[model samples]
Target: MSASNQGRIGVLLVNLGTPDSPQTPDVRRYLNEFLTDARVVDMPAAIRYPLFRGLVVPLRAPKSAKIYQQLWTERGSPLLYHGLDLQKRVQEQLGNDYLVAFGMRYQNPSVESALQELRDAAVSRIIVLPLFPQYAAASTGSVQEKVMDIVSKWWIVPSISFISNFVDEPGFIETFAMLGKAEMAKHDYDHIVFSYHGIPERHVLKGSHNGYCKLGNCCNSYNKNNRYCYRAQCFETSRQLGKALGLTPEQYTTTFQSRLQSRLRDPWLQPYTDEVIKEYPAKGIHNVLAFSPAFVADCLETTIEVGEEFKELFEEAGGKHWQLVPSLNSEPMWVEAVAGMIRRN
Candidate 1:
């Protein structure tokens, strides 16, 4: 191919999706597609297939739709809006050299569409960056799988590269710390909680390197064996952010949130969010600040779960104050950080 025909470089930003509408049918469609993914649910189809199709989707969709409705804005899903904004900001930062596109893994503006846009643009080199800062089989791995799957059928596939996880990236950590400190300065918080979205224990073990991850101190302490470990990554993210914010180990805690039903001996990150809120009073911890660094965009999880639900629980538990640090959204600094990452790659 001629040099002129090779085309521009392309960057696709992918995120977990939101429903097409705040309606049960739409939510069901989105949830069914999301939960059915083997990467997300992580159970064999023989087991999860019926459970997802027959039970969860049917029962949860309507309820989830209600929750999503509460999160919807004039522009539509907060996730979609912020993601679109991020795309524009990143593109503007990178100037005209790169073609930028955004996609939701489970809904409209699908990965297929995004990839097609890049392909049609004749992008010679394509970079896939999942918005998830931390890597998990269900999130980053799934995005990678989908990208490869789509490219596999193409007549001419571009030179594709995937940015797996940038949890420890200097710019990313700095952005997170800056946000956390800004939130903390507003009040005297006795506890700073780093709450990450939870994955099933089986999912963690599945990714473990020959039983290397016990999901305990072994996971918390940084070591080569557990370097790519998702649980470990969460801790490291918390630690780095704490250090940047000048928080001592005693002032901060790391835990997991949003766990679905599962029976596994291996613990998800300790001191679940609710438990942490409830225990804080007894421990003499009054004001609490929560940071959900795992999420790059504000969504139902951060808006409803952390902002409202957890705030209610914390207040009801005799805690004086409960505050949530907002997601990065389209902050100029965050856009610059992401743009820097793309350029470095």
Candidate 2:
């Protein structure tokens, strides 16, 4: 195919957003937009808005701002910068045939703006790749909803498609496995933990195909019934990564982390990362290597929560050498994987 024929494809890459700045006000603005989204919070506007703005944002923002302050680096948010890097390299890989734009679901470089860029390029079709490997209502679903909402109003709409979930994609599995292997080469890790962001239990049930998800060992295997179930997808991603890295079932544990609020009565995906980390030292599992596969790039959750906080917990509990295998941020294989997925879709 000539370059002109390949130019027919437009690619938009989306990720969960980050605050523009680590300042309290900026963080508050981010929290306000992110939490207020019904897909993330999953409550009616009456309850969601008031509770998030009045209670959650106020309580979380300043503390989160401080955490963000620590998380920020010379290039600003690692998440944003890495995403930009991925965009540039992926564009190069796809060559002149593709126009690749990156955007966040919440803050700067908003999803609408990214889609507009693609629309302006006048590509015949646009493919949206939400960076979340495991689909969830709050992440991928919200992006799908917003993209359709924006394009439906266009005077001339192109054929829009979404690459929703790619848990079984070989490129994704191989890339993550390679990262894990690199870390393993440096340290004799006693155990591996695959941490993914936690969503409310209701989110899983909402995606349940005829009650296939019971939130237990039901996720041990992947199948059509639980394909879109975020929890199941998380497990599957871990399973594939584990298999790729030559780990047995007992050698690794897959758990959820970063629940929205600890006080919320509603349960979330369990075996919380924090709780599980605390128990590891007592079990004689020292020297752990952690993987945050759900995140394509290292962000607050991977850098601060998993790398720092969990390391502290493990050390305090008498463990030694807690290390984090960094996320795939513009890693060449990852870029190739993304490009191939785009071509396939």
TM-score, one value per model: 0.96, 0.97
Each candidate: what lDDT? Answer: 0.88, 0.91
The candidate maximizing TM-score is 2
Per-residue lDDT for 1-345 in model 1, tens only? Answer: 543576778999999998899999999999999999999877789978798889888999989988988998899999999999999999999887789999988988899999999888888799999999989999999999999998999887879999999878887888878888888777888888988998877777888887898877876676778777888899999988889989899889898898774532355655688777787887888798899989999999898999899898888888889889989999888999999989889
lDDT of 2: 0.91
Residue 96, candidate 1: alpha-carbon lDDT: 73
Cand. 1 Cα-lDDT = 0.88
Model 1, residue 78: what's the lDDT?
95
**Clashes (N, CA, C under 3 Å) per candidate:** 0, 0
